[model samples]
Target: MTPEDRFPGPELPETGPRARLALDPLSYGYESGDHGGPQQPWAGPGYGGQGHGSQGHSGQGHGGQGHGGPGGAAEGAVHSGESSTVRGWFEAGGGATASGFDPDAPGRPPFEPTDPPTLDLGAPVSAAPPAGAPDPLPEPADTAPVGPLYAVGDVHGYLGELRAALYEQGLVDADGHWSAARSRLWFLGDFTDRGPDGIGVIDLVMQLAAEAAAAGGYCRALMGNHELLLLGAHRYADEPVQSSAGTASFLAAWRLNGGQQNDMDRLEPHHIRWLSRLPAVALEDGHLLLHSDTTAYLEYGASIDEVNDTVHELLASDDADGWWDCFRRFTRRFAFRGEAGPAAAGELLEAYGGHRVVHGHSPIPYLTGEAPGEDGRPPLRITGPHVYADELAVAMDGGVTMDGRLLVARLPLE
Candidate 1:
């Protein structure tokens, strides 16, 4: 059977442990030399999204050699090598200095950059106008439009699909260079593993960061579970781990999850450093953006900064067990699914401060109970994101790795 055959039939009504652990073999790649043991070809049961062709990385690492921010916190700082376009945008957005804007800071307000401009409530109104002479309302001043905000779901190495989606949104020019000036884009992560061009996907994102900034817009990403898995495979390799499914090694798990060999071979220190700095959770435009569907994030920290800092610090450490623990928690999913999903999403929103949670990990077809079409293939098109949990959360994964759609939706789900 071919790798496509590995895709399971329509998802079951209920997600079981087996469904949660369904290994999308097509998602992983292995360099022939990287794994010493006999290659486990995709002849057996595993996850679905596997790519037969090899993908290579040709681009070099970015400026700062991976560490660009002042001190150790690279968050919110611009790379020195970036063009003046992006540098100006960064400076305009107050990226030059750390205002120490904490979402959960005591006596301070949460970070809600997308909030509407506030009006002064204490302005004294002119003495009541005489009965027949009402003062003409001052004409409203004209203001330039702020660019639209865009979010892309899991790419899973489908570089062509990704480029097409971005082009469709006019975020990228025909040549795939950043074109949406003053607009913002956020990638929900999982650039590698499962599919054909993981490294290529990462390279594009890295390149676009500079281009987008130069255009007066910015592109940012969140850390996904697959990123953690890849890091574990590279760092811990075959080291054993304590898993609920008995003992397992990072390398073994990586291969099982469709980790590509070519992507691994091309993995560099700069890439590792870049991945390490990614924030696991963020609040954007009042939407809580995260990679996984699970509430396991709360285990890391109460606030977004705390959680991101903890993950970064853990990655910087050399403790294999600590890395294993971090990987294990990230692998969890569906914390905001099923009947209990709304309460979970609400709890997270209450604590993190957001009207709704937007994420990319679980697919919409699975959440909406839409079965694969005839011949066991996903629908040709996905109209938009799946809003669930009483509209408390919006799922964007679209399951590109599962023969489903690659979603890129505008924010503030209606």
Candidate 2:
């Protein structure tokens, strides 16, 4: 059955902080040398024993509930797509011919590849001055009126749940239009897969983006693993691609991970362009935000700016293997769990310049090893974002796939 069929409890009966769940001693996958190796300080497998074929994040079904799917910063944002973990179960080998970059293929991006894509890096536009140029003066901070900042985690495909969450925050009016005047909003990605109405969710987010910008506020999103998967499936279809463990095709992987046909059928060229334009990571108000909780982002660049640039550049390209590689690295999760969790969060913070790392991808219930009620225990009640890794990282995915709430929270959590 699908994640939606599997998890049918409640769509968030409560809100706010709840008691912390006890963590299992061996909750984190941690089998070292899977990829990061010893050279990378915060490297290891996702969930325990998960490898290229291991289960990291779960996918959901139709309606608005489900699970889904992360990477590194090179010079810009995560170009290698935060270096995701590959999930091809068969043996690795493929004989497919070159099959990307066709204009008719969904891989043919509609966005102008020439544009710098600096629209939402969220990083200050300062790195190195021109040769022999004096360092640029620090710009004045804006004192303009601004609304509160809020973040929504992995919507999967649940449009209704997302609408309620946004309405609860007064972000949208009764008519479901952007009503947050000057309030800033960010979607931590995973807009599709495992649920229904992913396209609808994207439409709402796109609408909000335009309306919010016009209102002097803004709506933005990060790239999620499912986005990459959907893009790949559209571009390559059933064409086989090589992965660390085996040969897999984008179409198969996408479907295996809760990719719905309706979303694919309704996907428009404009959607492709918008998805391609999204950055893999961003930093604002002292918070570093991303999709998955993996250190593969380090594989992309050394800073948030570099990581975002790299991801955009890659998505704009027609290289199917490169796209698959990107998807694989981001899939590797559980970086901020177990005893090494704090250190993993530290790696991203020290490199990216955020006081704390806020992310979605790994659901809070899975982090505690029980997923609440799954093992015959009472329902694992998730009321708010999970703060762990010594309080250095916050998990925003509320496991909507498991009948959990689609979370939306104010930033700078107390």
By TM-score, the best candidate is 2
Error of 2 at 260 (Å): 0.3
TM-score: model 2 vs. ground truth: 0.68
- Candidate 2 error regions (>4 Å): 1-145
lDDT agreement with native, every candidate: 0.57, 0.60
TM-score of each: 0.66, 0.68
Q: What is the lDDT of candidate 1?
A: 0.57
Question: C-alpha displacement of 412 in model 2, angstroms?
Answer: 1.0
lDDT measured at residue 157 in model 2 versus the true structure, 0 to 100: 84
Tens-digit lDDT string for candidate 2 (1-414) = 100001111111111122121111111222231233321212112211111111222321111222111111101111111111223321233222222111121111111112111111122111111122212222222544266788998888888899988877777766667777667899999998756678999998987786666565678899988888888877776566775434556765665455555677678889999999889989988899989888889999998889888888888887888888888777656677666678888988999988889999877666655354323466456777888777888888887866567788887777
